[model samples]
Every structure is written in C-alpha cells, then in structure tokens.
Target: MKYLAALVIALAAVPATARPQLAITFDDLPAHGPLPAGTTRLAVAQAVIDALKAARVGEVYGFVNGFLTERAPDLPVLELWRAAGLPVGNHGWSHLRLDDVGAAAATVDLDRNEPLVATLAGKTQWHWFRFPFLAEGNDPAMRLAFRHELATRGYRIAGVTMSFGDYLWNPAYARCVAKGDTAAIARLETSYLADAAETATAARTDARSAYGRDTPYVLLMHIGAFDARMLPRLLAQYRRDGFAFTTLAKAESDPVYAADVDPSLPPAASLRERLQAMGKAPAPRTDYAVELATVCT
Candidate 1:
C-alpha cells in the first residue's frame, strides 16, 4: 500500500443536522508485498474483509495496481468486492505519483494503469480512479486538462474529502516486527477515527467548511497489512459514530454529490515527487489529505 502523500481535500462547511454521507476507500491495490506477520497482501486484504464483516461494512472500493494484480492474480480481494457488490478501480501499475514526471511520462503511466484496471475488472464501464497520491494542485487548468484526457480515454476520477494519515503508519510486514508495534495497529485505528471526527467537527463549526447539509463525508484509507490489522476497530468506531456505510457508487449516486466521469490531473507519482511538483497545493496540507481525495472508498 505505498502511495505518495499529498492532499487536495475539499471539505465543505455544512450544518450538523445536514451532515454529509460518508464513504471509506482504500488504495495500493493488489498489495502483493510482504508483511511483518509473514502475511501477503492477499492474507491482509482477507483479514480486512473479515473485519468489515464484523463491523458490518456494507461496501469497499479497492484501487488496485495493474502489475500487482497480474503478479497476484489469485488474490481473493477483488472477488470479495465483486461478491459483496463493491466497486473496483485502478491506482496504477507501480503506484508511481504521476505529478513528478513530465507530460510524456504521465501519459505513459495513465495508459498503463487504465488498461491494467480494465483487464482486472474485465469491464468496459466508466471505472473510477484514485491517484497514487492526491497530488492534483490548485491549478484548475491542469486538473481540467487531465480530466479531458481521461474523458478521452474513458475514466472517472474519484475525489476524496478526508483522510486520517493512515498510510504514514502503513505497518507493512517489515514495520510490524521492526517496532514490535502490536499496539501500533490499535493506535492506527484510534488515530484514524479521531482524524475523521476532528474533520467532521471542523466541518460542523467552520464558517468556510467544505461540507454541506446534503453532503456525505468521504473518508479515505488503504489496503495495507496495517490497515487490515486495524480495520475491525475502525469499523466498530464508524458504527459507534452512527455511520451507515454504503458503496461509493451509491453514495455518488445520491444527491449528496454531483458525480462526474471525467479524467483528472497528470498521472500519479511518489509522495516526494508529487510534493516537489506541487506548483499550486493548498496551505499546510498533509500528503494524506491529497491521497484521501484521490482514493477514498
């Protein structure tokens, strides 16, 4: 679940009685890497699914890398989404942040990611996309140009509203044993919930909040082992918070948002490159904020 960190998060300020619907999404599709628990991405994803079940998660969107999907074709994660009626989309082939490279490079990255996603899903519909990092800058022109490109090729960009910096605590197989961080998993869960609540609180209070009365809060996460490790508690918290989870498609279909199927900014890149390419990023934004927008459930 490696994603470059950046944020283009747009949280609208809205009334408490008019709280927005929320959706949770995970990225680093086809995490076929190793984990401290000696668990593969496959094992971890299944654990996440089980946790979602225990937490009564209704829908999940997995943004997969095309190459990883090819490497681990047997991963049951995709099928889980299918059986559960969840949607699937592309993250990219190598999880590269597209903003770092030149236009040609970005084009190459998008071309590869899109087809891989099409191949994995075996579908020709308007599949959504989650940038490796939410690196799209405030340059409306850049974003519009990218969107037009995607529209030409057939892709819909999934915009995110909030993130809890989960990827920073990715807790891959190696990290798990490195810090003997059993509690790290629990910490990750609690911390993410807190982030969500904090964002919601801000939206509820701020005069310029990005949330609205009819808008649903959109939350972002990842598909890493650490994420799976903490998902049970996370879902429990969502239920505890009185959130009735639903699929991205259903949420987008609702009046809570005006969904579109156009493409988005340049391709994705690593976090550093995306930041360095940050010509017009907002003030004091975390990498998670940008990533959340591009990859939310």
Candidate 2:
C-alpha cells in the first residue's frame, strides 16, 4: 500500500504536457460509405456523438461535404451533430481531390461548402480545412499556392498525425452484417483494435524520432457505421494507453502544428514528413489493407 501510494504521488507530480495528448477528428460526415442494413445516417451520428460525450472528449471536429446533405434523409445527421455541440468544418463541397481538379476548381468547391458550415457553426470558428484524401497536389509549387489560397481565406489546414485506416473496416463490417457472418465480424473487431494499437505505437515512435519528443497528435477518423459501433471501445483503449483527449484547436496550439494552424507559414509537414525530410525512415507498421479487403467477401 505504501509503494502504491508513493507511485501515485510521483505520477501526480508529473506535468500534463509530459503525457501523450490526442485530438480526434472525423471526416466525411453526414455520409461516409455504404451504411449497414437498418442503420440510418442520423443513428450513426448520434452513436458517435454519444460515444464522445460518454468519454468526455472535448469538441471533436467533423468535416462535412455538404453535397451529401442533398439527400434529404442525410441532412438531419448534420443537424444532430451540431445540436450535440460538435463543430463542423469544410471538407470541400464534394470531397474533391485538389491534385486531380487543380487549384481553381478546388477553391470553388471549398467556397461552395462554406455557407452550410457557416450556418451550422454559427458563432463558432469554422475555418479549419482538411484536404480530401490528404492530397495537397502533386508538386511543391502547386501545394504552396493552394496553401496561400487557404491562408487568405482565414482557413487553417488540419494536419493528420495519427491514423489507422479506420474507414477500411467499415465496408467489411457492413458486408459481414449483411451476410450474417458473426465469426467474420468478430475477426474484424479484433483486427481493427489490433491495427489501431499497432499504428498508434508506430506513429509515436516516428514522432519521437523526428521531433525528439511526443508531440500532441491529431487522429483522423471517419464517421462510418462501424466507427460509431467501435468508438466507445476505441476511446477506452486510448485512455488505457495513457492519452488525454484534447480538442483539435488545443492540440494544434503546440508549436509543432504551427504550419498547419497558420497556412501562411508553409505547407505543413507531419511527423512522418519531418522524418522523410531528415532522410530517416519512419517506424514500420502492419499493412492490413489486403486482409481487410478479403474479409467478409
């Protein structure tokens, strides 16, 4: 008992900054991919919101493509999201790839999404922009030009530092549910958690190597049905791993995210990007794509 009490006191003396911090953000709100049987868009949003609230996660940003809301049933998903006090940001009007469409078309697409975001995010700062597919263009000059464009529009680029391809599991999960493949769904659940844990370790290792410390991380997730189902457990796992949840704005307030938060600085480089710039290899992670693709097929 004495040893336990001493250990608790020592840990309490450690600063909050010394602990790993993570901000969770979801993309493709309103609609992501094919929904599982009997699952409504509103239900998915509600489940995700409930999970975040239950975990006491602060102000998670859900990037929206307003195009999805054109389908009448999907529009309420955004309403429910905002009603729950979550913030919405622009994910392009149609989730266009800037590289494929060029800067002119991409900027127009971005502007088209602004009004909906403005309406939903009334009195809140909604100028954060997350690139669809995280593609900033195929060349440096093109990327810089787009960065300048975003900067002029009072937008901050949301940089992703931790991701595990959570979207990949959704389709497989939907398929398994449709087919009533209970065993396959069980396998998917186990693999999903395992991959998340492994990727997190790899991201932390890379960050420490690149920055000589564990910087605050922004984890990119999708608002798919499977995500809603797994989020509560996922939040528990992150807590068990000793991560304190933070808002995107708070996490990006760190100096490491300055470029992302201020587009005028330069194109943002994530931890892996910094490692590549330094001519060092990033930590290796398991590739679950092939396995995910085959599951429930």
Strongest candidate by lDDT: 2
Q: What lDDT does each candidate get?
A: 0.57, 0.88
Please give the clash total of every predicted structure, in order. Answer: 36, 0
The sequence of per-residue lDDT tens digits that candidate 1 reaches over residues 1-297 is 121121122223323443345678877765733466456656777887788767666667778766665655544666655565555776756666655653445557777876556655665342776777766534555555655666677666666655666665553324545666666445445556676566555433331222223355456787776677767867766666666676677565432233243343344332233334654222243334543332211
C-alpha root-mean-square deviation, each candidate: 8.9, 7.6
lDDT per residue as tens, model 2, 172-251: 99999999999999898898899899888888889778766677889999999999999999999999988899989988
Candidate 1 deviant stretches above 4 angstroms: 1-19, 32-34, 69-85, 123-126, 137-142, 172-192, 203-208, 211-214, 253-260, 263-297
Clash count, predicted structure 2: 0
